[model samples]
Target: MSMYVRVKRQDQTVFLRAEASDTFRTVKVALGDILSLVLDDIKLYGKDKETVLEDEGTLGGFEIGNDDVIFWGQRMDGSTFEPASGN
Candidate 1:
């Protein structure tokens, strides 16, 4: 069955129609279309901003159900991580 989910990116909110069986890759594709970004560059997180939604796993397997809100963020690369507080 198809379900609705919310995707938050900065100040923009996007409602998406997806199935629990859908993979994160599928969501990335749709988000790319809506957000006008490269499909392979889109990454997703949870409300906590720490739970990464990786590919090769079903949405259901991630325990994501109907009406879930996923936060959109940039994919981490070699230079993405940095120290928050440095002397």
Candidate 2:
């Protein structure tokens, strides 16, 4: 089974395809050697939600299902506490 993670940033969006068995937690591990952001610094959410700073565990437990997606990036507002959509 293959899964894809779509990483979005202010300047770009990238799709990473990987095996479903890979549990390399954290967006930093998923986007390795690309942009430089620590796991704690990476702000990730679904297409419809937001998460707290130390919430990587729950984020990781949910596998990206077949064709399922994960959205991750640096916060444009300069604060991890801010929402991505600016609502």
Candidate 3:
């Protein structure tokens, strides 16, 4: 089963076809491919915008499902953040 989700980085957001049963680690891998960054180098955020998503576990565990939004950036954890760049 696949879900379409919104993912943003810097000034752009892309709609991605994500496998629903995949782990957050899988999302990292796909984002790595899309954003040209290594898996370890990417950072992810959810709706709260304060929690850094480091979970290697499944997206279902995070309560994320279809049509969710995941914000991504190159900024390291603890670095200064601007408001997520896209809607």
lDDT of each: 0.74, 0.53, 0.72
Highest TM-score among the candidates is held by which one?
1
Model 2 lDDT, residue 4, Cα:
69
Give the TM-score comparing model 1 with the true structure, all chains together. 0.79
Q: Provide the TM-score for each candidate, comma-separated.
A: 0.79, 0.54, 0.76
**Which is the winner by lDDT between candidate 1 and candidate 2?**
1
Residue range with the least summed lDDT across 10 consecutive positions in model 3: 78-87
lDDT of 2 by residue, 1-87 (tens): 556666554446767776655543544566755666565556665645454323434333564555555555555455644344321
Model 2: what TM-score? 0.54
Deviation (Å) of 5 in candidate 2: 2.1
What is the descending TM-score order? 1, 3, 2
* lDDT (Cα, tens digit) per residue for candidate 3, span 5-48: 77876678867787767776778788788768777666678766
Q: List the residue pairs that clash in candidate 3.
A: none
Clashing pairs in 1: none
Model 1, C-alpha of 3: deviation from truth (Å): 0.3
